[model samples]
Target: MRRLEGTVALISGAAGGIGAATARRFAAEGAAVVLKDVADPRPQAEELTATGAQAAGVVADDADERGWAA
Candidate 1:
């Protein structure tokens, strides 16, 4: 569906498992996706992008409030 065509979703813990699945599902539903993980989520993002999805990956430590201070 094109319900999310103009949406942007930021998903944490997206390197694998549920978060990864959610990102893929959202992309399929037409949302631009931002995948965040402590580990590198770039590969998953790139894979989504290759399928003509708008996606980006971010390495972040959600535990550290300081890290998010940008």
Candidate 2:
């Protein structure tokens, strides 16, 4: 079984770079992933889901509490 089976991971800055890589890894391990980024991360999230992983994207600015609240 995968290490992250039945788990959920919240990843910030998940549109690219380290964050995107990490999101892929987590999903590979069987975790449902929530990707948050200042820009739209829906495309990446959709790709993951298409590959049979559970994933979601949310537009958020970690520096802004209002963004978090939304």
Candidate 3:
């Protein structure tokens, strides 16, 4: 069984660099990923979705409390 099967992961700073890399790894492990970044996380999320992984992207600044209120 995949280690992350039936799991959901929310990764911050996922627009690029290590955060994006982690998002990809989690999806490969069979987790549905929710990627959040101040930048655009959609491209990474879309890439994962195209590969048949469950993924989504959110544009939000983690430091901003108001971002999550939406």
Best candidate according to TM-score: 3
Q: Name the candidate, 2 or 3, with the larger TM-score value.
A: 3
Clashing pairs in 3: none
| CA lDDT for candidate 2 | 0.95
**True-vs-predicted CA distance for residue 65, candidate 3, Å:** 0.6
Candidate 1 lDDT by residue in tens digits, 1-70 = 5889999999999999999999999999999999999999999999999999999999999999987997
Error of 1 at 4 (Å): 0.6
Q: Find the number of clashing residue pairs for candidate 2.
A: 0
Clashing pairs in 1: none
Better of 1 and 3 by lDDT: 1
**Stretches > 4 Å off in candidate 1:** none
Count of backbone collisions in candidate 3: 0
Ranking under lDDT, best-scoring first? 1, 3, 2
lDDT score of residue 28 within candidate 1: 96
Q: What's the CA RMSD for each of the models?
A: 0.8, 0.7, 0.7
Report the candidate with higher lDDT, 2 versus 3.
3
Residue pairs clashing in model 2 are none
lDDT on C-alpha atoms for all candidate structures = 0.97, 0.95, 0.96
lDDT of 3 by residue, 1-70 (tens): 7799999999999999999999999999999999999999999999999999999999999889999789
